[model samples]
Target chain A: MEPGSEREVLTLALGIAIAVVSVVKRHVFRGLPRARRLGIAGASMLVAWTATVLEHLVFFEVLDTVEHLAYFGAALALTSWIVSVPRGFAEPRGPG
Target chain B: MNEALQIAASLVLLVGLVLTPRARTLSVPARVAVAVLFGALFVQQVLDVLERHRVAWADPVGDAIAGAVPFLWGGLLLLMVDRFHTRRLSAQRAQTDSLIDELPAAVAVLDAGARVVRTSAGWRQLFPSAPLDVPLSESVGPLPEALAAALRRTLADELRGAGDAERVPGEDRWWSWVVSSWQDADASGAIVMIQDVTSRVHRETDRESTQRLAIVGELAAGVAHDMNNLLTVLQLHVESMRRRSGSANEASLRSMEEAVQLASEMTHGVLRLAKPGEDEGRAQVALASLVGDTVRLVRSTLLRKYELVLTSTGRPATLDGSATRLQQMLLNLIVNARDAMPEGGRIDVSVVATEDEAQIRVSDRGPGIAPELLPRIFTPFFTTKGAAGTGLGLSVVRGVAEEHGGRIEVSSEPGEGTTFTITLPVGSHARVPQRRAS
Candidate 1:
């Protein structure tokens, strides 16, 4: 495998693993409104990684453009989610 | 346009990472993970921008940074989720502990190892010497042995019900407790709930004593009534003998009549005790004259070991009450004062009349009541004088005062003398003459 292909394949595997773990522990995201936005960011990153891996095989200009767009989407989602997160979201809440 | 959008997204992400309030509470590792995630994403975006502009060196660097984005993002996601879960659980535990601590009843939670894990405010009060994280048996103060045993039984799943009232070994306090075993998926323990029942126990005992006293009073009243009738006949015979006899026999006959009169008065006193609230013979009685008369009567009956002084404010302190009952109430107080000063101390009896009320104060220079015993002084069957006292004198005084729409108050210092003040409402009729005590 080419050096570029190797990096793409490794990135693809890691992205898939993250997506799988998230699916398996889906309950952790339940009731967390911020987690939905986080899930969007993670999914977009996975899409970008998939596009990168596919570009190594098919070598299309559109695939490369798609990869950049997906990366931009992931970054935008993550930034938006962080900005919108309420103050003390990380702070422990008192029991009712 | 895509390049500009990518750069703007990267810059905003970096700014959000810096400005977000969520970043403030992030743990060290979580903060580092987030920073690294943003760094990798920024590098990927920059390298992509450079590569799009046909910089040959940017290809390799862009590929390397791009491959790390997913890995860094994934790591950050997992770290934050785990931290949130842990913090939520900890907060929930803290809330539960706070709720338990504020519970009104004394409660304690013990682990399976019999170590006390948590306690309520009431529990802390009840066992101030008992500290947390210690076994029950190793508590500092005299831990009620029964409570410890109950906890053990609960933990063993042998006893899950309430225990009887157990007296604290050295203390007068009583505690009733309930112990139950509690188990969840992660842990098993016993929840012990204790209630202070000392007051309730005292109330129960007092009720029983009052009931017994009522029965005894009824029996005594019946016997006294019969004896009173016999004494009335004996008095008639003594009077007849006195009228028919000469001066030689008059002294002995007069003594017999006086003995009969004394016996009759004793029976009437007993009858009054049995029916204290009877309004049958109530009349407007002059208190000053009554106090003087009672004082003289007491002076004549007892040995003049202690000086009995009587003073009356020259105002008419009259009451529309049974004169016999009023005299009885005054006599009980004076006699109690006399008994208190067994070693012969001065007894002062004073009658003072205000516009609305009349006060009869009997003070004795006796060893005053202990501060602890002062509250229960007028409680029936409660006494400092053990065998020699029936414990009914002060109670009768209070009863009579209350029955006549009055109140009795007492003040004492341990070393100083004690004073009993009975205040009665001044009756509407004040025409009675005030008599001075000799």
Candidate 2:
């Protein structure tokens, strides 16, 4: 099998695992405090973005500056999620 | 254009979430949903940036990023279920807490191990030192232990029942514990309600004591009636004998007559305690003579320098009541007066008869009762004299006055003296003939 093909299968498996974890621990996520919930969500997004980046890198021999900058934008969103924890989203949960 | 606008709205929302203090109170799940919403929008922009850059190494990597989007949606769905489950449980807890607090019965909800999961306000008050998680035996003592054990056993066996009445050591409460099995969606336990019945036991004991006193009184009155008859016969026989042997051993006859009279008075005193009211026939009593007689009975014992004085007007004054009880009431008053004049004082007993009622006032020149202590003086068994006083003297006086359809009034000054005035209702009865002892 080709190296790129192997990487493709590995990324697919990684994506499937992340999906399973998100489903299983979804209730737990609802109970976490605001800072912690946002932190975990941001961390998970960073992991998913990194996994996708590795998948993108499998076919190319080298990277361009424009793509690096675009990747930097994804990093910036994850950073915002981390630093902005205290005032994260407001909504009312029913009666509980 | 729509995508660009969504990106702008999402960025604005993200700023609000991070900067505002108002967002802190929001529920975790609610906040998670909002965070997930903003996450999805932010990630979309990242994906678009990725696609626009179009690196040749990509092999449909957007699919992996797309995978994360589904999770955000999945987490929100689970959060909704969690919210419903938690909300119902919390509401039930608050509802039970409020209702059990209002109940007079002390209630405790225990887990399978007999640990207190929750308790009512009464339960908290009953065992104020106990914590929510303390064992039932530790909190309420062994009083609740057997009951809790039985309830837990019922749960273990999947049955339902109650426990017998039990007593808590070192406490007077008689507890009757009833437990119902508690099984809900999440857990199983027992709902124990404990009721105190101490007062009921005390009431039953008092009733028995009262009934015994009544029986003893009846027997004494019966004996008195027979004795009165015998005394009457003796009086007749003595009179006949005296006529037959006139002036021979007159002193011996006089002593015999006095002995019989004394026996009659003793029997009447016995009957008085046995019965009250119409059981003894009422008669006209000369008020002034009775007061003089009662005072003379105890005058010698009065502390030195304390004079016993009686005064009355030859008014149409009479008392219609049991003579024995009236005399007893007057004797009690005399004793109370003597005690008041511990150092030396004057006691004046006077009778004033009106058409409606007759008033007798016993005034004493002694250190008067303190104003603050006056109201409690008539309460039974309340005394300032400690071991020297039975405290029933004034209480008996007030009782007798009331039984005769009247009340006693009192007034006093700190250094001056105290006066007790007893008034009795006069029905359509004639005043007794005047008989005053000096």
Candidate 3:
């Protein structure tokens, strides 16, 4: 296969694997704050995008870093606050 | 800077959407509209990011956050559904608790492990010592083995559905218990209900006993009447024979007299037993002769395996009771002793007259009563001998004893044997009679 084609396939495969794992471990993620988990997912995605950005991997800027952090932070914070519930564990005596 | 401003705008919009008033109370269409509005804002934030930032920041960091907004909305919807479920479950639990608390019967909910979870007010009142989360077996006092076994079976069943009514044995009370399965989508357990059924059971038992006693009384009265007629005929024949012999056969005449007297006593005894409560005929009863006569009658009819022994320490162990009734009581005891030792065992009938009481003890070597069953031995219609027993023998003996201001006591051990003692006030009846040479 071609080098670019292989990289695309690899990226696609990695994304699919991570997505599958995230679905399975949804409970673990639910325990985490939604904002924090979003931040992690966004950071991971950034790393992956940066890998594709070999040509664009020149340097970092303050405006760029803050801007990137803002969107991820708000999304995750909204998600976490919205969801957070638990199920059960217990009993009763005789019928009345 | 443009990306940052867009992110800030998205934050403000997300907060505004979440804090929206009456989201839950809104119509489905309104909820949909609100969700759509939030979606549009999220899309707008991503679009602004793409417009301002390079693909490096936009696709990865910016768009990923924007994409997670829909998921956050999904999570919020799940939270709302979860709250509804919790509210419904709590309402059901409260209703069940209220229903059970107001019930007349004591009810308990047992978990999978047979541990008590929730209990009704009646249950708490009835068995105050039992507390929640304790195993039922541990909380309950010692129950009849059969009942305990049944309760265990109920707990094991997936849909426990069983009920039983049983006497408390030593006590006069009776209780009916029912076990049923209690389960919902979330929880599963056994619901046990206990009702005091003393009055109901007693009413049923009394009806049966009264019916049987009436039948028995009818039969006994007929027999007694026939015996009286026969005795009168015999008396006439003896008188004729006596007149013809002219006092020559004195011994034979005396023997006939004794036989006639014994028959008369038997007739009277039958009549007394036939009557429900006839306490008029009271006299100084010659307990020894009564016992001796009963023994003779029993020996003639008894199985060959039984060896009957009669011991009379004080010959005229009389009591201020009807001689016929005393004889009936003695005969009944002897008969019971004979019945007990079916495999040919020793039966001792002892009449020991003390200063205050005439104590007659009838003991037998046989398979004795069970300790658990011992307390119920005197209960009417409660018998181990299913079809063959009327379960009235002991009850009758107790009644007769109590009628004469006396009591019957029994001591027994399984496989060892049983002994029953009847104590009647000797009083003035202990006087020795003038004896004639035989």
Candidate 4:
């Protein structure tokens, strides 16, 4: 098989496996800590995205790999903010 | 394709190994075994990656890689199957161990070879320090021949799938046996689960006894009610007779009145047995103060020989219940603690808080309730204190707790001392407390 085709196949399989894993996590990790679950999910998505970026850089070499990496880095930052931002930030201080 | 198959097979093996069970909590050896399996799979992945990229491989490196690939693949396959088998065996052992551990009855298992395979933890209560895998007869040596025969027959019938055999009850212990046949890849075996069943069967018997006591309590209440009514009528009639007779028979009238009063007192005793005092209402009662008060109330019973210590987190914890009922509950616990230490030891009352509940634990440094009796301690009217105890104390405490949306549990070993825990909802009435007034 062509290296490019095999790489594409591997990437696809990894994506499918990750999607299945995320669904399994939703079903199985019901009792687990929410923060831990989010961490695992975020890490898995980042890893899958990194793999995709590496595959494209190796084969197509169209866009810079660093740009894709930076995009995932931003995604991670967004995930952190989404998880940690307090709902009651605008509430008044104590005793007032 | 071959490389992909190897990878797929490796993935399957890795998944299987990760899921194996250790008999105890996850052990070091088991974790190491899992890590080694992962390492082998990783090496295989690296080899496939190297070959795919056309990396310059030295002759030795190529041969080594090729040799290691199949070896690692084969090793992982064997290891996965091995781990699966081990996990199955461990599970069976765990099931057997927990069966013996938790069940208050003595249990023993016999294999197809009629060898003793598993025995319940309760076995030691009867035959202490007995060796495992010895012949059933040798272990049952202390028992009578007839009892031994019955036990063996039960074990045999269990192996044959003739349903579990029920052995004749022992003079000293209660015995029940369940046998099952199993065929593993390794060997065919019979698993005999021997249970002392003494406590369970005894609890059943105690239940019957409690039923009888309840009947008796009902009868006593009926008789007392009737007698109280008669005495009330008699006392009135005697007073009238004395009034009419005046000086003619004052002493006889006095005697009649005294007899009526005595009968009235007797009726009170009967009533105490038939219907324990009932209270209604929910109030926040501090546990520390309650324990202190109970200690004071039972001060004479302690007789300076035993110390009643009220240990608390001092958080001013409160439970919603009738203070009177709380006092009665504490009094029963204190009295029980005092009685437990006839030779005398310290009784510690610990009040602790859980996330959503308040826990009051009464622990005694006395000969704890025997393990056999631990489960039955909460059953109504089942007391080791014989005729002296009404056996209604714990039952009453439990009833009061349940009424307040709480529960009472006891944990004890023969020598390790007993802890009676009363857990009540943290705040009063997230909903209404169920209470009945008399």
Candidate 5:
């Protein structure tokens, strides 16, 4: 009902959606290099969502810090993955 | 420290964005989504910094951008994953196409409507005019009608799989085809494979002819043995009769002996045909004498309605070859000429000696071969005569000529006549000139 509460809900929904998509299309990531970093990024985003939901019950300051840390972790992993993309990714790897 | 970590993460994200190879690999929309994703994360980092510094209006902006960040990540992940799948599929399709193209057998894939989807290199070689996306029957090539009809039937589900070897009309070639229906998730069609089996068919025919010849040789040997015994008995009786009835029966006895001698010579010719090994060894053969002998043998067996004429240039035309095989070759040409004229016509057999070769010609005043059919006349198992012909005559003549280091040529006028000329290299043996004979 609050002005910012809706944004939290939407973020939580998107995190869940991303998790479901990753699980369903898990085969897509099998051969990719540094794919674990991408998974870590997704896990960090999920953790941030959980911390946002638990902020009212737990130590508010601590939970807020935890959420920001999780977001930072997700951003760091995502950036690492982006920078690590191989030059040959554009070229096809299979026989023609 | 948390705000410091956030600023570090944002800076790393910005650096990654600038250096990521995905900028060149990803599609336009995907690249934009990636940029937006990094921007949102950077904005969140900026909001964290501002809140840490007690700036106003940071909370609301942080909430809104935070909400958008996850969606952007989701969109970017989906886009990159989709791009990977597209590349993999494209690679697999390319591999399949190359595999098909490299296959030795002519192969084609058709849609449910029987239109060609793809073809192999062999298919292109076989049907150079056949183009992609065209109905096979409409393609300009020697695709047999039977194969096209079978393909249609197969695609229509009226036939499961069809295969046959068909001789191309007007061509001495034979093609074999196999068609089968294939069903995939998105489509159903037929795969057609074709092969040129002309040589295979010829080899099988030659094998069968060899088998038949072996059987005929055995039979001829037995008949020749019996005929020789009968001629020997007749010769003894003629000699006995001449001694009993002195001068008065001399002429009759001599005629009886001459008939017996002719019968003996005929039996010898049959024996020679039976035991090919006896004449397989090449020797100096006088073409004129061989032609005369063959004409005599043919005259004795031929119908009286046909006129047989033999001529020579009086100059000896000697060749190093199998005498019996040469005789058989001449016999086949003469018989072929005789068959051409059912109403009986003049067959001229001639031997002419040149400086380096001997030319033997058999001319017939019967209907000649068509011009279009000339090239195929020497092809094994090709025949112009309906059911009554064996189609092996000219091919045998050609084989024997080539075997003797010679060549055979034919010229024909459809209504007028046909002449078969066989030229053999002259042997190094001494040439013995003789008087002109007819």
Candidate 6:
């Protein structure tokens, strides 16, 4: 097989394997926040896609690195907010 | 197309969620089915990855196969669930059957079809000839006709909507029945449970009659007391008249005097039944002293040839009861023991004390109480001695014991003889003075 087709096949194979694993681990991974998980998976996918595009395309811009970093920073802030938020914020029991 | 498949798959999952077994309220079978379904779905996804080439995340056919595994798992899960539940049900049913069999009261169950489902040994013994239930109307013939009719109507009402009913079919027997509905896989039926309450009812009736008789006895004693005083006055006047009237006949005077004696004895019997000095409160009594006094009082009369043995250990057993009452109780017990050994046997009267209570035992070597008569010995006016025995001796003994917050018990075998045991509580010596005041 040509290298291009071989790469396509390999990526597809990897995606299917990950999908199976994701389904099986869904019950175990239930403890994590859904939005945070989605954000992480999305960020990883974008990073891998960007690196692949960059290897072929030599275009560069000063704003690109800043934008990427900003996006990652925003993601980290959102995750911290979710994790630190107390569940139900129960009233402390004591004398009135 | 892929988005469309994703939407369909999402809908399928939504449907499954709508039907998911609720954790708090789901049955064992439903819970197992849910778990199996979720597991099977995960397995199907693994299979799809192993078989397929590049596939979109939302390919309906691929995801459909994965989703359908849950339904398939439901079928397999239910079979195993059935086996588990069946074993559990069988165990519960076995426990219920054994409990019914071992019940002391007669119990019977009839199905909605009016067939006898089961009957306890007690039930069989109660009505051996009860025809296999064609219906309640046909089977229970020994029951009073009016009672049977009332019972049938009550049962019909219960069958219409679950309820309970009770009836007294005869003077000696009581019956209660309840109806309830039961559902199985393909059939629904009603259960009828019948229980006999004869012994309990009889006990309650006897207690009521005894109370009524006690009231009557008190009234009779009151009337007899007044008459005795008047008769004594009449006899005194009559004797004075006989001496003052020098010409009065001797035979008439003798007859009148004999009549007066008979009336006096009758009046004494009434006074005894009334328990003349019972109004006096309980006093602390020494067990050894009481026994000695009782033996001495009865030593004057020797109606029986029996050897009397009176013995006690000096345990200082004291009771909170009137001395006269206690003496009377002991006298009655001694007389009973003496009478039992008419031909010539031994009588042992002993006082024993333990940590919590004190006991006085009067045992006789006479023909022991018949097994059937032992239970009824304390009933007022129940006597084996026809006219010779008033049957009030043991009953009065029990009454005295109870008035003192004590109890009397009798144990016997046919050939061995009988033991009458009286148990009284042991109070501290300090309370003796206070008890005397009360």
Q: For residues A53-85, could you state the per-residue lDDT of candidate 5 as single tens digits?
A: 778667877887888788788878877777665
List, residue by residue over B1-438, the lDDT tens digit for candidate 3: 546656775675576466543344433543554455455546657665675646554444433443454444344434444444455566667877788778766988888777888888888888888867878867765554555666677666654544456766567667777777766776677777777777688668867877887898789889888989998999899889988999899899888887998778767766766764544456677777778887887888787888999999964666666665566677777887777877788999998887778888999988988897787778776666777777777877776777677889999988888999998877663433211121
Best of the two (2, 5) by lDDT: 5
lDDT of 1 at B48: 76
Per-model TM-score (chain A alone) = 0.83, 0.42, 0.37, 0.35, 0.76, 0.36
Query: TM-scores across all candidates?
Result: 0.78, 0.51, 0.53, 0.41, 0.74, 0.39
User: For candidate 4, lDDT tens digit of each residue in B68-131?
Assistant: 3333323332343344345546666666577666665666665656566666666667568777
For candidate 5 chain B, the 10 contiguous residues with the lowest summed lDDT are: B429-438
**Candidate 2 vs candidate 4: which has greater lDDT?**
2
Candidate 3 accuracy as lDDT: 0.65
Who is ahead in lDDT, 3 or 4?
3
Model 5: runs farther than 4 Å from truth? A1-6, A28-34, A53-57, A60-62, A90-96, B17-22, B140-177, B220-264, B277-328, B334-357, B361-386, B390-438
- Candidate maximizing DockQ: 1
Root-mean-square deviation of each candidate, in angstroms? 5.6, 10.7, 13.0, 21.7, 6.2, 14.9
Cα error of candidate 5 at position B368, Å: 8.2
Off by over 4 Å in 1: A31-33, A88-96, B1-22, B51-60, B97-145, B148-199, B232-253, B275-289, B299-307, B311-321, B339-344, B352-358, B370-392, B402-407, B424-438
Tens-place lDDT per residue, model 1, B1-438, is 668767876786677667544655666787788777877788778877887899998889878887777778877877788888777777777878999999988888889987889999888887787888877666535557877777778888746867667787887678788888888668999888888898788778678877887899889999999999999889888878777776779878878877888789889888866765444466788789999999998988777688899999947877877677678889999889898888897999999998778999999999898888888888887777876877788887777777677889999998789999988888672333221120
With candidate 4 superimposed using the best TM-score fit, by how many Å does residue B34's alpha carbon deviate from the native?
Answer: 55
Instruction: Name the best candidate (by TM-score).
Output: 1
Residue B291 of model 6 has an lDDT of: 86
The residue-by-residue lDDT of candidate 5 on B1-438, one tens digit each, is 667677777787777667554556666777788778878888878886897788879988988898888888788787877777777667767878889889878999888988889889888998887888877766635567787778778988747555556887667678888898887558899988888898788678767866776787689889999989988988998888888888898887887888899778668867865554454356778788888988998998899889999989947877766787778799899999999899998999989987688889999999888898898789765677855665767987887787677789999999999999998877563333221121
Q: Quote the positional error of residue B333 for candidate 5 in Å.
A: 3.3
